[model samples]
Target: METSDLAALTDRARRLGADGRRRVLGIAGAPGAGKSTLAARITEGLQGRAVLVPMDGFHLAGAELERLGRADRKGAPDTFDAAGYVALLRRLRHPEGQEPVYAPAFDRALEEPVAGSVRVPADVPLVVTEGNYLLLDEGPWAPVRGLLDEAWFLDADPGLRVSRLVERHVRFGKPRPYAERWVAGSDERNARLVERHRARADLVVRLG
Candidate 1:
């Protein structure tokens, strides 16, 4: 079923952690579709019982993207370290004895991934991971769906999503014109790819 109630969503996440066994809940969405925002809210609602591990942290460094000639399409599936992200999911699912797990974080200001920026304590019961490709069924992304205990796909109006992406890019220092172009060109292309996998999610969330 589709829902837009934030309180109900947060309550659902709370129940996910009630068993005390570590479980991962994934929030997948297109660019500017609110994946990170939803993940953070869920994590905060859990009151330290859950942690946020974003898939953006697995983005290939700018230099590597340039070397592979994929810099222009930075958010595409091929531009991220997909396997590494999957491996981290596995580790979070089954941690070593009494040890905390560390995950990378993306630094939006630097436009780079910072290694070991998130620490998942051994006692946290839920891990909320968000990304664009969590429900993708191709190549390395195929394993991600199985790793998640529950997955939610966020869908938003196309025009609103594009506008959010433009504002985000401009806020991050891109000129308004370039931000608009990049959102229309790169972000929208990836958004279409992500939207195709919507049926794979356990739930579909529509935000107003």
Candidate 2:
């Protein structure tokens, strides 16, 4: 979490995109391991050379989840639009004279995806994407690993991560007891799934 570490990551991002082709950097971690925060910091440090397209944007709609009987495990791997996410990544990788590729953004307030909310310009050299399942090797998630130039896994103390997740759920309007129970149940399951693929990452970053 040092400034120098972020600087190094920024430099690495720059180099990955130096060959005149767009580079995708993926940040993967457990539910509350701070992948999104690290991705934002790295993109900010890169100045304007990078854009962020988060995996959360591909979260399936509430209605869709309910229809599929997955509403109880909304954050699980199967609850995402994995194929759509892969297709978007493919498009981002080879823009080829097309206009800026618009990506979806997740709206936490409404718990839905807003289409075309993020614009990735043709000239942007880097795309930083963060999510829990980037390193997952099962089903539709397996292809995600090959699309990224570099993948980083963020790790943190289990108790601290669980606390952060609980607070986040509370901030998003869940009651304290419900939030704690959800984290101990659904989020913990997803966290373990993510952890199983940690060794596949190019870098494993331990955050305080």
Candidate 3:
């Protein structure tokens, strides 16, 4: 993406008050595309004005996945509670005259989604949610796009993404061969599905 677009994106977030009533900013991309990193950077720059509500927080609990016999398909789009994620987004978009809406957060240490771990306070505006399927228009994820005020799709070199996946898996205790296999079989599939939604984004962010 051009430098002017990032400036505009940041400006848009800046214009939203810290009152949790403004529209949300969505960033969608395939696995290892730096959605989280970009989201974190933007929110961090705001210094508490923006909060990141990542889609990974909606990942099905490990135990639930095992029970459903889909633990092997962890990164698959269907593996997540897409409907629940949409519901949460709806609530965030329109916070009722109540305390606030709290969503789950995925704990990397536990490899599970912990309920009520992220509290989107009633006063914090500019929700920066990033995920692979935000721009995807199918199934439960279809409703997600309409809820977002604006969205960006991140593009990166495929080789860089593959390398990042391999290192990620290795950090999680998998051998190099197994890491490569997981990246090829699981992550790659998710990446392909995510690519189909790139056209739905408002801007294309190419990571340099």
Best model per TM-score: 1
Least well predicted 10-residue stretch by lDDT in candidate 2? 1-10
Which stretches of model 1 miss by more than 4 angstroms?
A: none
- Which pairs in model 1 have colliding backbones? none
- Best-first order by lDDT: 1, 2, 3
- List, residue by residue over 98-151, the lDDT tens digit for candidate 2: 589999999988989999999999999899999999998889999999999889
- Checking candidate 2 for backbone clashes, the offending pairs are none
Highest-scoring model, lDDT? 1
lDDT of 3 by residue, 60-145 (tens): 98888999999998979888999999999988888877587888888876788889988887777778899989988888889999
> Estimated TM-score per prediction?
0.98, 0.96, 0.92
lDDT of 1 by residue, 64-149 (tens): 99999999999999999999999999999998889899999999999999999999999999999999999999998999999999
- Model 3 clash pairs? 1-206, 20-124, 20-125
Scored against the true structure, residue 192 in model 1 reaches a CA lDDT of 90
| lDDT score at residue 28, model 1, on the 0-100 scale | 95
